[model samples]
Target: MTNVLIGVDLGGTSTKLAFIDENGHFLNKWEIETDKRDSGKYILLNIVNSISEKVKELKIEREQLIGIGIGVPGPVNFETGLVYQCVNLGWGETQVKEILEKETGIPVVVDNDANVAAIGEMWKGAGKGTKNMICVTLGTGIGGGVIMDGNIVHGVKGAGGEIGHIVSVMNDGFTCNCGKKGCLETVASASGISRLAIEAVRKTKRDSKLKEWYEKRNQLTAKDVFDALHEGDQLAEEIVENVTKYLGVALANIGSLLNPEKIVIGGGVSAAGNALLAPLNHYFNQYTFSTVRISTMLVLATLGNDAGVIGGAYLAKTYGDHIRKIKHNSYIKELT
Candidate 1:
C-alpha cells in the first residue's frame, strides 16, 4: 500500500484539502466552506469530519497515511503549529497542531499559507530544479514567500518574505489593507490595478478604451487594463507602466537582498501573461544591480490554486514523522 499525506489550505472563506502520495501525485482533492462562528472553533471539527469521510470513501486504512500538513492564512510557528492573528478568519492566537493531532490521532504540521505555496512551486511547479526562489501571489491582496538554500525563510515573527507589504510609493499613495500607505499590494494586485484605472479616468480626460468599458460596466478589472493595453490604448499603457514600475523596483530590491534564482509570479494578475511580465521585466532589469540581473529570472506561477495544498503535502512528507516522534517522546517522558 502506498503511503499518502493530507494537505489542507485554510482560508477565510473556504478550505481546500488534498490527498497526495509520496511521489507528489494528488490522489484526491476537495473544498469546504469555512465556518467562522465562535471564533473559528468549528473549522477544525469540520475538517476532521471531512477527512474521516474521505478516508472511508476511499477505503484507505489509517496505517497507510503518513500525516497531515496545513497552511493557514496567518503567521504560524512551524515547531508548535500555533497560529497568530488571522484577521480575516477572526482567529487570535491558537494551537492548531496540537488540537488537530489530538482530534485525528495523526501527526500534523503547519506553516504560513504563502510559504507553503512557495514550497509547492519549488517542489513541482515553476521553481522546479531550482533551490532558491521567491513566489509572489497577486490576488485580492498580495502574498509572498522566499525560499533560500532549499528552505523557506520563516523569520522570527513568521513574516519572512512579505514582499507585497514592501513600500512602493513613498508619498500620497492609497492605504493598504495592512493599514499602511503605498504598499506594493495597493498598486500591483488585481484590485489595485483596477483602482489605478479608476483614478486615472477621474483625474484625467484621456481618450481611452478603458473609459468606455468603465462607463458601461461601472468598474474595471486587471484583465480590462491588460486588454486595453494590448489594443494600443495610451492611457492603459500608462497605467500598466505605473503598476509594473512599482513591482519592478520592489522585486529588484528583493533581488539585491536575496539574489534568488527565480521569482515566480502567481495569482489572477499573472493571468495577463506576457502583457504583465514584459514591462515588469523591463523595469526589473533596469532597477536590478548589474551583477545579479543575469542570474534572476521572473516567471509566472504554474501551480495556481494547488500550490498551497501541494506544498502542505510536501511538508507532511518531509517533517511530519520527525515531529511526531519528538512529541511522543516528550509525552512519555512527562508521564514517566
Candidate 2:
C-alpha cells in the first residue's frame, strides 16, 4: 500500500482537498463548498465524509493514509490544532485537529492558511531552494507569512506574520477591517487600489483612461488601474505608484526585521506582473537598508490558488512522523 497524505485548505466559500504522496506529488485534487451553516458545525463532518468517499474512489485503504494536514483561514494553535477564529467561516474557538481526528480516525495537523501557503511556495514555488522567505498575498485584503531558518514564526498570539495590519499611514488614514487606521491593507490591497483610484478621480481633474473606464463600468478594479497605467495614463501611473509605495515600504520594514532571502508576492493583484513589480522593487530598494536590499530578492509567487493545499501536503509529509509517534503513545496509554 502506498503512503498518502491528505491536505485540506479550508476557506470561507470552499474547501480544497488533495491526495499527495511522500515526494510532494499530487495524485488527485478536488473542492467542495464550505458549509458555514450552524456556525460551521458541519464543516469537519463534511470534510471527513468527503475524504472517506475519495479514499474509496481511489481504492486506497484507510491505513495507507499517513495523516491529514489542514490550513484554516484564521489564527491557529499549531500544537493543539485549535482555530482561534475564522470570521468568514463563522467559526470561533474550535478544536479542529481533535474533532477531525476523532471523526476520521486519522492524525491531524493544522496551521494558519497564509503560513501553509508560504510553506508550499518554499517547497515548490518561487521560493524553492530558499530557507528564509516572506510571502505576501494581495487579494481582497492582504495576508502574509514569515519563515526563518525553514520554520514558521507563530508569535505569542499566532499573528506573527499579519503584515497587512501594519500601519502605513500614521495619520488621516482610512479605517481597516481590524478597526485600525492607516494599515498597509488600506493602501496596497486590490480593494485598496480601487478605493484609491475612485478617490483620485473624484478629487482630481486629471484625464485618465481609468476615469473613462470607471465611467462606463461604474466601478474599477486593480486590474483596470494597471491596464490604464500600461496605456500611459498618468493618473493610473500615479495610483500604481502610490499603492506600490505603501507595499514596498511595508515589505522593506519587514526586511529590516527578518532579513529574509526572498520576499514573494502573490494573490490576485500580482497578476499585474512587471507593471507592479517594477515600481515595487524600486521603492523596496530605496527604503530597505543596503545590506538587507543586497541579500533579499523580491519575486512573484508561482503556485497561485494551489498554494494552500500544496502547503498542507508539505506539512503532512514533514510532520507525519511526529504525528505517528503521538498516536502510538496514545494507543499504548489506552492499552495500559
Candidate 3:
C-alpha cells in the first residue's frame, strides 16, 4: 500500500491538517476549530478524532499513515517533547509528542511553529533549493527560524532560532509579552509598527494623514500605514523607516553570524510586497557586514498560510525514509 504523511499545524484559532504523499504534494487538506477549553486539553483530542474521521472518509487504511509532524507555537523540549508556556494555545509543560503518538498510534515529530514554517519555505517556498536560509514571519508578533546546511539549528533546549526576541532597543522601550522590555518585537512586528504610528500621531506636531486616521478610526493598522506610505504620506515614510531600522540591526547581527543564503520574510505584513521590502533592504544594507551585504538576499515568502503544513509533511517524509533505511539494514544483517 502507498504510504501517506499526516501534517498538522496547530494555531490559536484553528488547527490545519493535511494528507501529503511521499513526493510532498497535498492529497487532501482541511481545518477544524481549536477547542481551547480547559487550558487546551481538547486540542489534541480534537485532532485525533478528526484524523480518524478524515481517514475513514478518504478510504485510507490506518497503516497508510506513516507518521505525523506537527508545528506548535511554543518552545519545545526535543528530549521530552514538552511544550512550555505557549501563551497562544494556553499550554504549559504539555507532552505534545507523547500524547499525539499514543492517541494516533504512529510516529510524531514536534517542533516550534515558526521553525516548521522556515523548513517549509526552504523546502518548497521562496527559499527553495537553498540549504542555508532564515525565515521571519511578521504577524501580530514576530516569529523566526534559522536553518543551516539543510538542518534546523535547534539549540540545547530546542530554542535555537528565536529571532523576534533579539534586543533591538537598549533604552526606554515598550514591554514584550515575554516579560522583557526593548525586544525587537516591540518595534518591528505588525502590532509594534502600529504602536509606533499611534505614538507619532499624538506626539508629532506636523500635519499627517496618519493623524487624521487616528482621529477618525481612533486606531491604525500596519496595513493602513503601508497604504499611506504607498501614497507618499511623509509620516508613514518616517514610521516605516524607524521600524525597518530596528529590523535592520537585528537581521544584520544574524546575517553577519550565519551568512545564510536567503532570508525569507513571510506573514501578513509581507503582503505589502515591494513596499515593505524596499525600505527593509535599504536599512539591512546599511547595518550588514560588507561581504554579507553583497551575498545574502532578502525575499518575500511565497507559500503564505501553507508553510506550516508543508513543513510538517517534510518532517514525516524524512522520518519515514529513516525507518525504511533501518529496516533494510536489519534485514541485510539477518541474511548475512
User: lDDT-based ranking, best first?
Assistant: 1, 2, 3
Model 3 lDDT, full chain set:
0.90
Query: For this target, which candidate reaches the highest TM-score against the unseen true structure?
Result: 3
lDDT of 1 by residue, 1-336 (tens): 989899999999999999999888999999999999998889989999999999999999999888898999888888789998788888999899999999999889999999999999999899999999999999888999999998899988888978889999999989998899999999999999999999998787877899999989999999999999989999999999999999999999899888899999998899999999999999999999987699999999999999999999999988866776898999999999
| Candidate 3 lDDT trough over 10 residues, lowest sum | 77-86
The alpha-carbon lDDT assigned to residue 259 of candidate 3 equals: 89
The lDDT for every candidate, in the order shown, is: 0.92, 0.91, 0.90
The candidate, 2 or 3, that scores higher on TM-score is 3
Q: RMSD of model 3, in Å?
A: 1.2
Q: For residues 136-176, what per-residue lDDT tens digits would candidate 2 score against the true structure?
A: 99989899989899888898889988989999888899999
Name the regions of candidate 1 deviating beyond 4 angstroms.
Answer: 321-336
TM-score of 3: 0.97
List candidate 2 segments past 4 Å from native: 324-336
TM-score, each model?
0.94, 0.95, 0.97
Q: Pick the candidate with the highest lDDT.
A: 1
lDDT of 3 by residue, 51-78 (tens): 9999999999988998998999889975
